[model samples]
Target: MSRPHRPGSGIRSAWWCEFSTRTPAFGDGDERVLLRAQSAETPTQVMVWIRLAVRVLLSGFDPRDTERAYHWLDHGQWEAVARLADGEPYAFTAAAGRTHVEWSARPVLFLPLAHTATGPLGRCAEPALCACTARGHRCGGHRR
Candidate 1:
């Protein structure tokens, strides 16, 4: 019913960052999951740090850990932007795929650095904050 946000900026494509999620694969009443990004391929030596914002309505992990996990992204270079309990098995593997942006479980209207083929998406006032809910209206943004 809802779609996840996608970013089309060169940050993930041109710069070569890959995004993926980790979730439990076995029986569980409770579990931890994580969504993160890494350099699948890049030419520059300067590390590209991702500012991940989790807007999930409900997560398997502790809700209190959400905001704190978001800030953890700033401190690490291609590390777990989100943390979840490892009690569950995960088959997730980070693959190099081109995208402009992405969301965890729901679609969101994320700001792009520039205008895309679809249309222009305004930049987020907070540099660290890129995800937003534009209701049901299309915001004309992509992650490729």
Candidate 2:
């Protein structure tokens, strides 16, 4: 088995995010099933807009529509980032806790910024799985 990546720096920790597909099993076996998220706790409209604006400013206009942006994130960027960070590899799904994470990307997939723990993690420092950099190795910072 592989060891979980520990965040080494605050910025790295803040950048990497994760979600699991396993949900608490409920009801009888026949009726029970892993529940997927229905909606996001808070939508990613603002973040998406900011990212899009930055992209446009840096590059140029993208011909894709809004949904495309969401898909690109849900299936593309988010997955790549998680994989780099060694996050549990699983599709976007919610648990019975009723914690719904929609869009499965960016602001939606990312844990709320407030949950971050301050200070260094000592020897168990969280590893950074930076996508903007090279392979999924510790670059710096922590988030979980």
Least accurate 10 contiguous residues by lDDT in model 1: 84-93
Q: Score each candidate by Cα lDDT.
A: 0.32, 0.35
lDDT of 2 by residue, 33-119 (tens): 222222222223323433444334322223333345456545655544454345332233222233222223332243323333765
Stretches > 4 Å off in candidate 2: 1-14, 28-121, 128-144
Give all candidate RMSDs, comma-separated. Answer: 16.0, 17.2
Task: State every prediction's TM-score relative to the real structure.
Answer: 0.22, 0.20
- Alpha-carbon lDDT of model 1: 0.32
Q: 82, model 2: CA deviation in Å? A: 16
Q: What is the C-alpha local distance difference test score of candidate 2? A: 0.35
